[model samples]
Target: MPYFAVLYDYAPGSDPLREHHRAAHRAYLNETDHGTVAVVATGPWSDGEPGALLVVSAPGPGELHAMLDRDPFRLHGAVAQRRIRSWTPVTGPWA
Candidate 1:
């Protein structure tokens, strides 16, 4: 199964928003299961940075979009840019 990598670039100084949405965001990720086809690994892009990476898995773009639509940030209009791309892993757990 192919995977997808979605990068989210949040606006600067959005801590309060992030804090408020933390639980909901995490819950949203948990609700969308990656199973064997997908996995989500997230963390700050850098110290005090507002960027995050939302790694996902699916067969195609449609599936990816559907998943993104359910994300808490999207629902609350807090996400800045949501970039989606198809990924081919040459090595790692999935390999």
Candidate 2:
């Protein structure tokens, strides 16, 4: 499995909706384990940015894409912008 870093910016005023679907999102992350689809890290960004970052292990690009497609926030328009990138670590824990 390859590592990937995903960042998604939430829509303005979508906090309520995100709160409503928070449980579901967390649940999906917990249950969507396919050995390779491991969510290694996740958290929100500070500085008035309504967004989150997730570092995960995925088998391929399409697998990651499908995972995001199934995310409640993305499906519900809470995610206004995103940047997903493949990571190759040489000195970090993953390395």
Candidate 3:
């Protein structure tokens, strides 16, 4: 499995909606206990900018996209722009 840093580029002023879906979003991340998750974290971008980091793991690009599609926040339009790329962590805990 490979890890990916799924970044959601959201428009400004969407924090409330993002917080509202936090619980469901957390649930989804936790559900990936069978080696499907490498690492995961969520929070606003730099300087209170609107967006989130959804770093996790999948078998490949297809698997990653499928996982993103299942995210609750994705369904509710909390995510504006979704970026998917193969992640290589050189340091830190998940690295």
Candidate 4:
């Protein structure tokens, strides 16, 4: 498996939308939060902002896309921008 870092930028005034889907979002993440093909860690970049960083593991880009495509926030038009990249960890607790 390879690591993929996902950056999600959401539209403004989407707070309500995000809150509405918070449970489902968290549930999904918690259910698949770690393993060979799952979300490694995720959270908001700052307060009162809809930006998030999700480090995940998957076989390739296709699987990554498929996994992220199901995000409740993204499905409801909360996400304005999404960037995914392959990452190579050199050293650290997560390495």
Candidate 5:
């Protein structure tokens, strides 16, 4: 398995929609069967930005993207963009 650093950029002025679907979103994250994918860490940006970062493990980018597509936030149009990149944690707890 490989790891990926996923960044979710929220759509402009979609706060209300995000709030409306927040519980569902969290539930999805907590309860979904991601198959080979494993969510390592996930949370919203605390720097006054409307976005989130999720570090996960999957077989590849395609599978990761497919899994993310099921996210409540993404399905409900709360996310404007998603950036996925390969990540290698050579040190720290993740290493």
Candidate 6:
């Protein structure tokens, strides 16, 4: 499996939608299969931007995208942009 760093940019003024779907979103992440696509770490950015960063392990980008597509936030258009990049950890807990 390969690791990926995913960045999600929330849509402008979509806080209501995100709040409404937050439970389902968390549940989805919690219920994901470890062998398939494990969510290593995830959290919202504390900066001025309204977005989140997620480190996940999966077979590839296609599989990761498929899994993410099922998230409530993505389904309800709370996520305006998504950036996926391959990650190789050298000297961290993930390594």
Better lDDT candidate (2, 5): 5
Q: Which one wins by lDDT: 1 or 2? A: 2
Q: Using Cα atoms with residue i matched to residue i, what is each candidate's TM-score against the true structure?
A: 0.81, 0.87, 0.75, 0.88, 0.95, 0.94
Q: List the residue pairs that clash in candidate 2.
A: none
Give the distance in Å from residue 1's predicted Cα in candidate 2 to where it truly belongs.
2.0
Model 2 Cα RMSD, 1 decimal: 1.6
Q: State the displacement of the C-alpha of residue 65, model 3, in Å, after optimal TM-score superposition.
A: 0.8
**Model 4 lDDT tens row, 1-95:** 78889999988888899989989988877784433468889999977566999999899998788778888888998899999989988899567
- Candidate 6 similarity to native, TM-score: 0.94
Q: Which residue pairs show backbone clashes in model 4?
A: none
Best by TM-score: 5
- RMSD, every candidate, angstroms: 2.4, 1.6, 2.5, 2.1, 1.0, 1.2
lDDT of 1 by residue, 3-74 (tens): 777888875666677789989888778764543335557666877566778667777887778777777777
Candidate 2 CA-lDDT value: 0.85
Question: In terms of lDDT, which candidate is strongest?
Answer: 5
Model 2, 26-82: lDDT tens digits are 787777564457788888887767899999889887878887788888888888988
lDDT of each: 0.73, 0.85, 0.74, 0.85, 0.92, 0.91
| Worst window of 10 by summed lDDT in candidate 2 | 28-37
What digit string (tens of lDDT, one per residue) describes model 3 on residues 2-95? 7887788874566787689879987876784534545466555777667767777778877677777877888877788899877888799777
For every model shown, the clashing-pair count is 0, 0, 0, 0, 0, 0
Cα RMSD, model 5: 1.0
Per-residue lDDT of candidate 6, residues 48-92 (tens digit): 789999999999988899999988999999999999999999887
